[model samples]
Structure formats: C-alpha cells, structure tokens
Target: MRQLVRAAHIGPSLAVVALATLLAIADGLPAQRVLLVALAVLAGQLSVGWSNDLLDEARDRAVGRSDKPLASDAVARRTVLVACVLAVVAVVALSFACGWAAGAVHLAAVASAWGYNLGVKSTVWSWAPYAFSFGGLVVFVSLADSPPQWPPWWLPVVGALLGVAAHLLNVLPDLDDDERTGVRGLPHRLGARLIPRVAAAVLLAATLLLALGAGIGHPASLVGLAVVVVLTAAVLLGRGRVPFVAAVLIALTDVVLLLAAT
Candidate 1:
C-alpha cells in the first residue's frame, strides 16, 4: 500500500489538491462545494501521478531510479493501473457533481496533464500541459461558482506563469535521468544552467502580475510583492529542498494576495 502511495507521487498530488482547495475557498465556495472541488482535483491529480509512473516505468528502470516505486518493483504495475482507472472515474463523477462548466474545465486540465505523460513531456511543447492545466484550474474554480462566471484575466495569466515555472523546476532534478532515456523537453533544451534562472524569472513575473493586477497602490499588494521577491531569491539561492519549499511559499503568498484582492 505504501509503495502504491509512493507511486502516486503523493507530494505533488497533494500540492495540486491543496491549490484547488485554496482557490475554492478564495472564491467563497460553500463548504460542501469546496469539498467537492478538492475531491475532484485530488482524483484528477492521483490519476495523473499514477499514469506518469506507469508510463515512465521503463525509463525509470533504465535509469536505476529506485525512488520510483514502479522502477524498484515495490508495487505491481497492475495495482497502480487499476488505481489510476478508479481515480479517473472518481474525478469525472465528482467534477460533474460541481457542475457542467466546472467539470469540463477540470477534465480538460486532467487531459492536458495526461497528454504530457503520454508523450508531450518529451517534446518542446512539454510546458503547454502545465500552462493549460494550471490556468484551467483557476477557471475551474470560478466556473464551480453558482453563476459560473470567469475569473479576472490576470488570474489565469498568473497561474500560467506559475505553471511554467513549476515545469522548469520539476525537470531540473531529473534532467540527467531524462536525457539518459531520450527525453528532451523545453527545459532540457534550455539546459540545467539556464533553467533555474528562467524559472526564477517566471516566478517573479507571476509575482509582479499579482501585485499589479491585484492593486498596485494597495499597501498589502506592495508587501506581498516584497515577500514574493524574497521567496523568489530563495528559490534561486537556496540549496536542496529549500528552493522547492520557497517556491511553494511564493505560490501560497500569491494566492492569498489574489484572494484578498478579489
């Protein structure tokens, strides 16, 4: 069970779910609706994670990536496959439970991520999935509202920027392994040395959008921008998990400010 859980990429899965939950709350969703959004996002994320592991199983094994449960044979591939299928079903039902608009947006996001897993991750267009998925997440939350309205344009822009940054950062740790297995995404083409700088720049751009889009003159917006700058610096300068942790913090801060602005 633990191995199966590991195979699901639990950390990233939970982070995506948490972002959905926060967006729901920021949108002033009722508790029940918020829970529905969280469940739908969770199911979608689980499916994405599981499928990614399943698809990459051979590559992982080739690279001797023991950290991957499928690569290490810690869990049966069939088990993970079955779980992924279940998650897909649950995501579909739960997302529609929120409403047609919300469901469609959520499903589209899931599909984009699945596209990445299937083969897009190896192409220059790898970043497209993350941009669409993350931007669609913002739209999904808004459409989940009773009236099903769209969010302010800046919100989805910020989300897309963050998504791009996420893609770059995510690939940094696996660049070598991916290269060994013939994977060459946009980040891979950018090379390791430049990816971090690009990621930091992307993150900073999101922060700027949040500040200016939210309300440039607002004292809180200025404070939030300052904090985000500090966090972005940490992402560039920090070692090990520090950069990732700081990136997450920067995201949370931006979301909070965005919510407040809205």
Candidate 2:
C-alpha cells in the first residue's frame, strides 16, 4: 500500500486535485458539480503519476531508485495496471456526469498525460504536456456552465505559465539521472544555468497576464501573480530550496484566489 501510494506521487497529485477543485469553485460551480470536478481531477492526476512510473520503470531501476514501489518489486505490474485502469474509469465516469464539455476536457487531460509519459516529456517541447493538462482543467471549470468567455482568458494563460514553471522545477532534481538515461527534456535542453532564467520569465509572463486580467477587474487573478513574483525573486537570488517552497506558495495562492472568488 505504501509503495503504491508513493508510486502515485500522492502529494503532488493531491495538490493538483486541490487546485482543480478551487478552479471549479471559483467558476461558481455547485457543490455536486465541484465534487465531480474534483473527482475527475484526482483520477486524472493519479493516472499521470501511475503512467509516469510505469513508463519510466526501466529508467528508474537503472538509476537505482529502489524506493519506488515498482523498482523495489513491492508492487506487481498487474496491480499497477489495474490501478491505472480504475483511475481512468473514475475520470471518465465523473466527466460524463459533469457534461460533454467536461468529458472532452477529461479526455484531453488523459491524452496529454499519456503523451508525456510515452515520450513527449523527453523532447524540447516537454512543456506541452503541462499546457495541455492544465488547460484541460481550465476548460473543464469554465464549461461547467455556459461556453467560456474571452475576458477570463488570462486564467488559462497564467495556468499554462505556472505549469511550465512547474515542469522545469520538477526536472531540476532529475537532471543528472535523466541525461544519463537519455531523457533530455526541455529542462535538459535549456541546461542548468538557464533554468532560473526560464522560471523567472515564465513567472513574469504569468504575473503580467494576471495584472492585465486584474486591471480589467478580475481581482482574484492577482493573487497568483503576487505570489509568483515573490517566489521568482527568491529563486533568482540563489536560494537553493526556494523552488520547492515556491511551488507550495503558488498552490496556496490558488487556494486563496478560489476562496475569494467563490
């Protein structure tokens, strides 16, 4: 059980679930609708984590990451397969309950996640996975009612930027192992010296978008931008542990925005 939990990357998966739930609430979804949205997000997140572990099983073993359930032989391959299938089923079921637009977003999320696990994560456009995955979440939330409006378009723009920053930050710890194993994603292509700069740029763009969105009267939009600016400054100043801390801060900002908006 422990191994399975770890393999699912439960912490980050839950964080994504929380973010999706918040997004749903911010869009003024009903309680039942919000629950369905959260369920779909949770299942999608678990699917991503499980797929990552399954696809990178060999590489993880080669890197001596025996702490992983599969690498340590603590969980059977069939068990993992079953778990992935169940998660996907839950996502699909929840999407159907929500509506066709939500169902389509759910499918997009699953496809993007699978694409990332299969090979897109090792390419120069690795950030594509984050864009598609998070954008799907935004679409799901927006479509909970009527067709999405363009005035709130900055929401997805900020989300995509934050997602890309997350992708880069996530790859930081795995750079050496990834390169040794031929998994040179966008982060690897950019090199270490450039990571902070790229992170800064992404956060900056997100902040600008949020500020513009706020100027147009979306007060809740500035929450994430303020958090990103402070966090980006910390990262740029050479605080080694700031990236991980910033991630939590970013998540918190999303929570705050949701609370305020809802």
Candidate 3:
C-alpha cells in the first residue's frame, strides 16, 4: 500500500493543487470558487496519476519496481479503476460547482494528461504533457473570476519554460530505466550531459521572465524569481537534489505572491 501510494505521486499532485490554489487566490477568486478550483485541480491530478500507473504497469513490473502498488499487487486493478472513476467524477462535480469555463479547463487538463500516459509519453514531443498540463492550470486560474487576468501575459510563457524544466528534471533520474523500457522521449533524446544544462537554461529563462514581470511594479513576483535563481544555481553547481528543494521554495514564493497581489 505504501508503494502504491508513492507511485501515485500524491505528494506532487497535492503540490500542484496548492499551486493552483495560489494562482486562483492571486487572481481574486471568491472563497467558494477557490475551494472548487482546488478540488477540480486535485481531481485532475489524481486522474493523471492513476492513469499513468495503469498504463505503466507492464513496464514498471518489467523494471522490477515491485514497490509500486500495481506492480506489487498490493492494490487490486479494480481498485485503481474505481479510483480513476471517482477522480473523474470529482472533477465533474467540482467543475459544475465552479462554472462551465472552469469545468472546461479541468476537462482539457484531464484529456491532455490521459493522452500523455496512453502514448504521447513515448514520443519525441513528450514535453507536450507538461506544457499542456501546466498551461491548462494557468488558464483555469486565470478564468477563476470572470475574464481572468491576475498573472501578467508573460506568466504562461514562463510557465511553459517551467514545464520544460520539470520534464527534464523529472526524467533525469529515470533516464536509464526509461531508455531500457523504450520510453525514449524528448528528455532521452537530449542525452544525459545536455539534459541538466537544458534544465538550467529553462529555469534561467523562467527566472528572467519572472523578474521582468515583477520589475514593472509587483515586487512579490521577485520572490519566485529569486527562488528560481538560487535553485538553478544550486543545480548547476552539482547539487542535483536541489531541484526538489527549489520546487518547495517556488511554491512558497507563489503563495507569497498571491498574498501580496490580494
């Protein structure tokens, strides 16, 4: 059960939910709408996680990753199926509670994630999943109130860069395993030596944009930029595990930005 839970990557999903909440709050979403948006975002993430486990079960087992719930048989296939169904239902319910526009964003996110897990993850354009997933999230937060607007126009651009970094970093540790399993996506194509550099470059671009976004006036935006700069420097200096730490700092910075914006 522990392995299964970890395989679900629930913690990361929660982080994504928290990030969505920050974006929503920053955009001035009402309390009720914020709650609904959080639920929708979490549900969408759960759907993605569950679907990934299901689709990767064969590969995971082949790699001897018996720690995974599905791989270890700690949880029944039917259980995962039920979970996926419930997650989708939750998304629908929250979407309805939030509004059609919000619901559309959730559905789009779910669709994109599902697409990636099913087959897109093996393609050269695997980064599309991260881009679409984060993009949909930004759109959802942007549309939280009425017409949306909190994040500057450049937010999504920075977000795309962040998405690329996420993809590269995420695949770093799994490169060998992924290659052995024939999951030679974009990250694999980049090769090991270049992947970290790519990640650094993406993080740098995101920080620059974030700084530029804040320079016009919103000082709070600098918080995230600062975190990114420090974290990126750490990673480039051979502190490989620093990305996870940087992720936490980034999340905190986002929260601070939201509070300042509001």
Worst-scoring 10-residue span by lDDT in model 3: 251-260
lDDT of 2 by residue, 17-104 (tens): 8887877777777898888888878888888899889988999999988778998899988888899989888878877777887688
RMSD after CA superposition, every candidate = 2.1, 2.8, 3.0
Ranking, lDDT, top scorer first: 1, 2, 3
State which candidate has the highest lDDT. Answer: 1
Quote the positional error of residue 141 for candidate 2 in Å.
1.2
Across 1-262, the per-residue lDDT of candidate 1 in tens digits comes to: 9999999899989988988888889889999999999999999999999999999999999989999999998999899999999999999999999999899999999999999999999999999999999999999999998988799999988888888988998888899999999999999999876776677778778878888887788888899889988987887888867777777677667767766765
lDDT of 3 by residue, 153-255 (tens): 7676666666777777677778888888999899899987677767776667666666666573555566566666676666566555564555535534543
Candidate 2's TM-score reads 0.88
Better lDDT candidate (1, 3)? 1
TM-score on alpha carbons, each prediction: 0.92, 0.88, 0.85
Top candidate (TM-score) = 1
Give the Cα error of residue 182 in candidate 2, in Å: 0.8
Best first by TM-score, ranked: 1, 2, 3
Residue-level error in angstroms, candidate 1, position 161: 0.8
Q: By TM-score, how accurate is candidate 1? A: 0.92
Question: Which is superior by lDDT, 1 or 2?
Answer: 1
